[model samples]
Target chain A: MTVLEARDVSYQYSVGTPFQITALEHISFSVEKGELLAIIGHTGSGKSTLIQHFNALLKPTSGQILLYGKDINETKETARDARFKVGLCFQYPEYQLFESTVYKDIAFGPGNMGLSKEEIDARVRRAAAFVGLTEPMLEKSPFDLSGGEKRRVAIAGVMAMEPEVLIMDEPAAGLDPRGRRKILEMIENYRRQTGSTVIIVSHSMEDVASLAERILVLNHGKIARMGTVDEVFSHAEELQNMGLNIPQLTGIFTRLNQLGYGVNPLTYTVEQAKTEILRYLHKGGAADG
Target chain B: MENDSLIKFNDVSYRYESDTDTPLPLAIKNIDLDIRKGEFVAVLGHNGSGKSTLAKLANAILAPESGKIFVNGMDTSDESLEYEIRQTVGVVFQNPDNQIVATIVEEDVAFGPENLGIEPKEIRRRVDDALKSVGMYEYRFHEPHKLSGGQKQRVAIAGIMAMQTECIILDEPTAMLDPKGREEVMKAMQRLNKELGVTIVLITHYMDEAVKADRVIVMDSGRIVLDGTPRQVFAEEETIEKAGLELPDCAKLAHALKRSGVNMPSDILTPDEFVEAFQRCVSGGGVL
Candidate 1:
């Protein structure tokens, strides 16, 4: 089932002003329930502008957004419901964290929903646990925590709402490899447990290659391409020309194929590359150099 | 005292003092390092690992509590030489929004040199030169707020370059930027190092970025745990793991291929190298 759909969406910044600029134009895509979709684009490529329309954060200047077959902006109640059903975790969300303590910060979203105190407490604890925050950490000032910890707390704030469709922009950005792995794993676990649709806006081709079931490529306020991970990444030259990158491993395989190596050009991960190389060697390839 | 050393840290240590009930941990402790002239040094560490503190110490924004720092020929601890030291060492912080002060692009790039009391004519020359160096000369008339994150970051770097600082230290300058912006900033750094001969000290969490540096330094628990060329440092998997880091994609794949009884070279740090090595092995009859 389609969880969210953008029907010919178009957005303009500062419309009617002298500096008005088109950020997204005639973009159309539908996100399925329980699917992990990765949106890849260069800077100023309309990835952020497009996602904002999903939760009614920014109404389109020309088109419409539908959540579960209902127009989000059709009425006030529908728009509000769309906001609750589609949670957005912005880039550098840690900066938005404002409560005195981590617990209070995570509780902010649920509290605004008018949930009972006991229900709020349970949701907050579960969300914190999903992000690997310990009980003692919830009591400490969010300011005193490490940068990675503070980012997790910010993500937990969104998770506490238990939205059916969670969208995170650049979720693993600015993290070391280990930290990136932990955060991505946390996101995966959350998706599995909740069976919620996950959409991530990312610049890392490697992260998208590994995690995303389908990928969307945006360029200059337009949908350049949208397909499965393999399908999108197969067009390496097109992505490079658009100022976007393919996974590093894919680049290598593409080069190898160009050089008459005849290797599998669709390889995106390390395991696949390793297996392909081994298979080539077993088929009478030499090691005499 | 080394003649070639542009910056030196002699047993540096720093700890933040907080009045809150919760105690703050030491920011950096017992560190010693030397950055030679015209070298590109990349610093890698997890958050709270004292990497930012190290950047602050380089330009005398934060003095060492128990050690000493020298920029070029001036001691950072000397009050009389503070201006000279700051002029010699420029720092570009993580957040581009915070560092940009001017509404217009050219004006922001001129902020640093103007503060040095340079004449207006000289400031104009420096501003034009800096903007062109970062490929932002076309946007010089544009408003800083209207520019993308990458464009704004380039403006920030140009601001530092206009000051004619001998060395530039960036504290996770690309942390908040998208991939394209990150690439733009990295290319600018490379140009500054290669064409202008300016020393660069980059602090980043991305291993791929670190691989492009002339040298990589890994810090943990407020101390330098690993320091070597990118190839040498990334070759040690155990050390990287202990320091809360990981090998680049190429290096990890090479290691795994080697373990799987494929003839893969161990020093592969990039995809190009990996492809070349694999082609050689396949044609030369390497054991499977």
Candidate 2:
């Protein structure tokens, strides 16, 4: 089922006293239910602008977005409902945590949805658990929690709304490796439990290679490429031309291939590379041997 | 102290004013370190672990409550050396948007030199030189906000480079950037260190970035927990894990392989290294 679809979306940002910048132009893509998509791009590639359209945070200048087969901008009331259905966790979401306690912060979304007190409490607790925030930590002041904890709480706030589609923009930005792993694991677990469509916008190719099932490459405000991981990563030259990099493992494999090694081009992750190498070794080192 | 030691922290200990316990919550504790001239040192630590505080201390943005800090032989605690310290070691913060004061790129680059009261002609020369060093001279006429995050960050670095300070401390300079932005900033730092002989102190969470530095310092809970070369520091996966930090992807894969009884180098940091190691293992029939 198509959980979210963007048809020829375009966005423009007014600049200076007279000029306007076209951030995105005629971008088209559709995300299916329970699928994980990653958007990769350089700094000015309009990945942020495109993701903002997923939740109706920014209206498309020329196209339309449909959530669950219903046009998001069909009506003002529908757009507001779209916001609840598609939860957006922005980059550096910790800055948005303004509530006193973590529990109160997580509850804010459910409360805004006009859910009952019991439902709000239940949602808050469930969201907290989804993000790996312990019960004791929920009652503590969000300001007192560490940076990673604050981030989780901020994500929990959005998850409490029970959005059918969750969008995170650089969710692990500025986090240590362990913190990054923990948060990504939490996200994966959340997806498993809820089966919601997840979109992660990140610059790290390794993260995208590891987590995302489908990859979308954005360049100069257009959909440069979109496909499965193997298909997208196989176009290493195109991605590099757009000032983006493939995963380091894929880069190494490409280099090896250039050096006359017959390594598989479909390998995107280190584990896949390892398995391929082991199989090749077990069958003798030569390609045809 | 050695003649070339640009910055020295001698048993420094600091606590925030808000904490009022018997032994206050130490922001940085028992830090005895020296940064030599032209050395590029990377500091790694989780958030709230006091690495940022240590960066601030190198420039005397925050004073050690109990110990002494010296910038180029001048004590930081002395009021007379305040200007000298500020002029000696420049700081670039994480948020480029917040640190940039001027609307235009060239004007932003000129702010540091202008504050130093350099001649107008000299200021222009230094601004041009700084922007050129970071490969941002072409965008000198551009507006700061119109630039990409990476470009703005490079402009911020140029602002410090224009100051012509002996040392530059960047606190998570790539935190707000994409991968390409990070590569650009890291390359700029390398150029400044190699070509200009400027001492570079970078505080960051990315292990891959830390690997490029000459030395690595890891902090946790306001103390220097680990300090060594990147290989030495990262080899201690236990300590890294205990500090709530993650290893680079290559390192993690290596560790995983080791756990599965594959004999690979634990110090593998890059994908190339991992690939080479795996190839060697295969040749030796090490893989099951």
Candidate 3:
């Protein structure tokens, strides 16, 4: 089922002014239930603007967004409910952490949902665990925690709301390797546990290659391409022409193919590259006849 | 002085004051570092690992709680020489929005030199040269707010260049930018170093960016845990992992190939180097 759909959506910023700009135009895509979608684009490619429209944070100037087959703008209640169903976590969410304690911060979303105290408490604890926050740290001030810990708490705040479609914009930005892996794992765990649809807007091709089930390429406020990891990364020349990059591993294999090695050019992940090389070695250092 | 170090830290230690009378741990402690003149150095650290503290110490943003820091032979702790030190070593921060103060690109580029009370003609010349160096001369008339993040960051670099600083320290400048923006900023930094012989101290979390630097410094728990060339530092995968970092993907692949009994070097830093080594092996028929 299409949980979220944007039908010919277009958004304009500062409309009716000399500085008016069309941020997004004629954008159309549907996200299915329990799918992990990664949106990749350069800065100011309308990735952020498009995700903002997901939760009705920014309404399109033209066309409409549908949630579960009903136009979100059909009724104010539907629009309001869409916000709850599609939680949008902005970039650098840690900066938005203003609550005194980590526990309260995570609970803020559930509390806004008007859930019972016990239900809110349960969700808060669950969300914290998903992000690997220890119980003792929950009572401490969110301000005192390390950068990685604070980012997790902020992410947990959104996860507590239990949104059916979780959308995060550059959730792992500026984090170290361990922190990045932890957050990516937390997102994967959240999806597995809730079976929720996940949408991530990121600039890291490697992260997208590793995590996303399908990838969407945005360029100049339009849909440039959309496909699975291999399908998208295989179009390396096109992406480079658009000022984008393929995964380093994929690029290595592509060069190998150009150098007369028979390795698959679509090898985007490290594991696939490893397996392909091992197979070639096992085949007596020659392409299979 | 034999190495012509531009910045030096001697037993420097810093601790942030607690907000609620609860004692906080030291931010950076007992750090000794030397940055050579006209060298491009990359700092790698997790958050709160004292990399930012080190950058601030160079430009005198934060005073050392103990010991001393020297920028261009002047002590950073000396209030009398603060202005000269800041002028000598410029710092660019992560957010492009915060660094930009002017509405227009050329105006923002000229803000630093203008603050120094330079003549109008000299300011104009510096602004034009700086903007052109960063490849942002075409966007000089555009509003800074309307520019892309990469272009805004280049403008920030141009602002720094307009100051005629000998050294530039960037604290995660590419953290908020996309890949294209990152490439742009890195290219600008490289140009600044090569063309002007400006020393660069880039602190970044991205391993790929670190590959371009002449030397890499890894920080952990307020200490210099690893310091060497990119190839040397990244070859110590276990050490990097212990410091909460990772090898660049190309290096990881090369290591994996070596581990699986392929005769490959373990220190491949960039994709191009990896391709070259793999090609040699393939053509030489060493590793199928």
Candidate 4:
């Protein structure tokens, strides 16, 4: 089922002025329920603006945004409903964490929905648990925690909303290897437990390859490509030409495939690369070497 | 004091004071290290591993509580030499916007030298040279806020260059940038380090960036756990993991291949190096 859809979306940044600019032109895509999608592009690729349109945070200057077959902007109430149904998380977790305590910060979103007091408490606890936050952490100031922990609190705030679709921007930005891995795992586990559609915007091609089921590549505010992992990453040159990157490790295998080694070059993860390289070497791939 | 050393740390230790009764652990503990002149050294560690603290200690931004740090053989603890120490060892932090002051790019670069009371004519020359070095000369007249993250970061580096600092310490300068921005900033750093003979101490979590350095330092629990050339340090795959870091993608692949009885080298850090090693191994050459 399509949880969100963008039909012929076009947006202008500065309308009717000398500096008028079209940020998005004829953009069209539909997000399926329970799918993990990643939108990738350079800094000015209209990714943020495009995601804003999904949640009705910004209405398209032309065209319609649909949530479950209904236009999100059909009425003010529906627009507000789309916002609650699609959770959009911005980068820099600290900016989103303003409440005094971690618990309050997590509770703020659910509280805004006018849920029952007990229901809100239950959702807050569940969200905190989903993000791996401890019991004592709830009483402390979110600002006082470590960077990783602060980010968890911010994630919990969004997860507490229990949106049908969870969208995060650069969820693992600025984290070390362990922390980065943890965020990716948390994103995965959250999707598994909740069965919610997940969308993330990222710059790390490696992370996107590992986590995302589908990739949406944007360049100059237009969709350059949208496909499965293999479909998108297969065209490394095109992606690279658009100021993007592929996993360097994958590049090696891909280059070998191009050189007639006949090795499977579609894999990006380490486990798959190891198997493919081992298979090639064992099969007397030594001649071309 | 070693004559070739630009920044030397001798048994240095520092801990932040806590306002509450709870005592805080040392941010950087008993670190004895030396960065020689004109060397590109990259420091890697997880958050709170004292990499930033070490950078701060080098520039006299934070005084060591136990030992001493010398920039050009001048003690960092000395109050009178603070200005001189900072002048010699400049720092570019992770967020470029925080360090940039002026609206225009050239003015932001000139802010450093201008504050030092340099004449306008000389300042203009220094500013232009610095901007050109970072490949941001064309953007010099543009507003600093309008430039991309990588461009803004290069402008910040130009600011330090205008001061003519002999050494620079950068703390995850590319952490917030995209791939292209990261490439731009990394290129500028390399150009400055190689062309101008400026010593570079970069604190980063990116393994690929660390591989380009002359030396790689790994810190853990406020101590230097590993220190060697990129090849030497990355060879210790187990130690890197214990330090809360991971091997570069190629290195990890090599390790996996070796575990599966393939003859790939365990120290491959980059994709090109991996491709080269894989070819040699497949050619039935002796294990390297």
Best by DockQ: 1
Kindly indicate the candidate among 3 and 4 with the higher lDDT: 3
Native contact fraction per model: 0.74, 0.59, 0.70, 0.63
**Greater-TM-score candidate between 1 and 4:** 1
List lDDT for all candidates, in order. 0.89, 0.86, 0.89, 0.88
Clashes of each: 7, 1, 0, 1
lDDT of 1 by residue, B1-288 (tens): 489999999999988878777867778988999999999999998877889899888888888888889888678888888888889999998778899999999999999999999999999999998898777898898889887666787889899999989899998888766666678788888988998899999999888899999999999989999999999999888888888887887788899988887777888998888878887777656665
Q: Which residue pairs in model 4 clash with each other?
A: A286-B282
DockQ for each numbered candidate? 0.64, 0.55, 0.63, 0.55
Give fnat (model 3): 0.70
Runs of candidate 1 with Cα error greater than 4 angstroms are A285-289, B20-23
Error of 3 at A257 (Å): 0.9
lDDT of 4 by residue, A128-216 (tens): 99889999999999978888889889998989999999999888887899999998999999999999999999989999999999999
Estimate, for each residue in B1-288, the C-alpha lDDT of model 2 and write its tens digit.
499898999999998776435665788888899899999999988888998888788887788899999999999888788888999999998778888999889999999889898999999998998898777898898889888767788899999999989999999888867766788789989988999899999999888899999999888888888889999999999998888787876787778777766778889877778768766775576654
Which residue pairs in candidate 3 collide?
Answer: none
Interface RMSD of each: 2.4, 2.8, 2.5, 2.4
TM-score, per-candidate, Cα-based = 0.96, 0.93, 0.96, 0.94
lDDT of 1 at B206: 83
True lDDT of residue A99, candidate 3 = 85
